[model samples]
Target: MVSTGLEDLEQSFSSQIRNGWNARPVFVPAEFAGMRGRLGVHDVVMTVERSTGRGFESITVASIQTDEGTGRGDAATSTAEAPHDRVSLTVIGLPELGSPLPIIGIDMIALKGTLSLVALDLAPTSTSFWDDVCEKRLFALAEDARDRLVIRKRPEFAHETFSRHAIIAAARPGCEEHAFAIARNFFTLATDVVAAAMGRVGDDPIEARNRNLAWRRSERQNRKEMNALARMFGEDRARTFIDAFLFA
Candidate 1:
């Protein structure tokens, strides 16, 4: 069984989003609609490495979904399941930021099953506001996925699995500020959860130290980029935008 506790899972996902957003170009002149329309559907393949000398293992052909629709409530919710037709691959690579690198690619798959809710959360939504909400939800799903993957080395999440198989379900779209709040709450919660779990499970001192080192290195790199962004857009505005999109 994989050793992903809920806390670790959440932390891993939160870290991924933080890095992805922070590393992205400061200004994407493209309008939200353009970005949404260009969204790609893909399959996720995840590879996990165990700290306990358990070696490494992977799962392939997982589904990913993205929806960027204009509807405020109903329409936003309805499109959440749109990525069911594609398969995604997530490769674990050398530490890029504070977490493993996910080299993502997508493919179309003929065999259909309900997408694991955890995977569906990674989908893009219609606007920044909706994206923020979905980002928080996705972190939740990531937490669940980490746990299941650690224990089973495969996707698990009864609710998500069922949702994938059933008629499509919609996620509530929220205002940008509200969505940002949700993502922030999830990040804090997930961080706490993982820290507690790590404390309980205990970790190899060497590995822990190494991870801390990697995190610090990543932090330095992020700070440099953040500084550059601050210069491009006034510091205050840059910070505000970064805070908003970091999780979205």
Candidate 2:
């Protein structure tokens, strides 16, 4: 297996989540761990990790890497001149049953030699949370990243799922470091949001839960991602994994 530099970045983000949240492993099926197999003419590797902490309901990170690489087919998502070899996706799900905090998400795709895309967001559950908890810090980070990188348009569902301050951008050859820093900064800010939500009162729990459910429904409707996963894995497995790890 070759390194697309995503491995290190994924490790860094996972470590931060573990330490900052005092997270403990959530049960994962054996098949989702250290899985190696063949997909078409290319060898494939994939992993899924899930954890839960005091204030968080669940946190999930998953990665998919293909030897021959794959194109996302959206130029806005990937400005790389070539296909990408690895993708790292993370979602830090807040406890929607209690707190109306935003869900933190980051997705990164790396070409064979360089980064192609980095999309980071604190997906808001309510307008008040967006304004009070996320607006200022998130926009500051987004603006800084935007100043250095080429901003990309979100997919249709993402436009509905992500907050206004979401940073969806492509980091060209020389801008990988800036993109990584922005991702890290967003993760840090997300942890701070979690800390602030501890013991903090929120709006109606029923409303918060319903909003999060709506967000997950929209996210799961992403056809491109679902189609790609179905192609590599079976449709049933893909759907199961999506429901279990990616959005659950």
- Candidate-wise lDDT, in order: 0.28, 0.70
Q: Which numbered prediction scores highest in TM-score against the true structure? A: 2
Q: Choose the strongest candidate by lDDT.
A: 2
Alpha-carbon lDDT of model 2: 0.70
Report the lDDT tens digits of candidate 2 across residue range 1-248. 12345666678778877887788888878876655544444556677788887556778788776644544455423322333355545454655454677777777765334555678888777567668888999999989987988888778987666888888898877668777777777878887888877777666667667777777887788786777667777787778777776676
Q: Write the per-residue lDDT of candidate 1 for residues 136-184, one digit (tens) a residue.
A: 5445544543433221222222232111211112112222222223334
Candidate 1 residues lying further than 4 Å off, grouped into runs, are 1-174, 191-201, 229-248
Alpha-carbon shift of residue 25 in model 1 (angstroms): 34
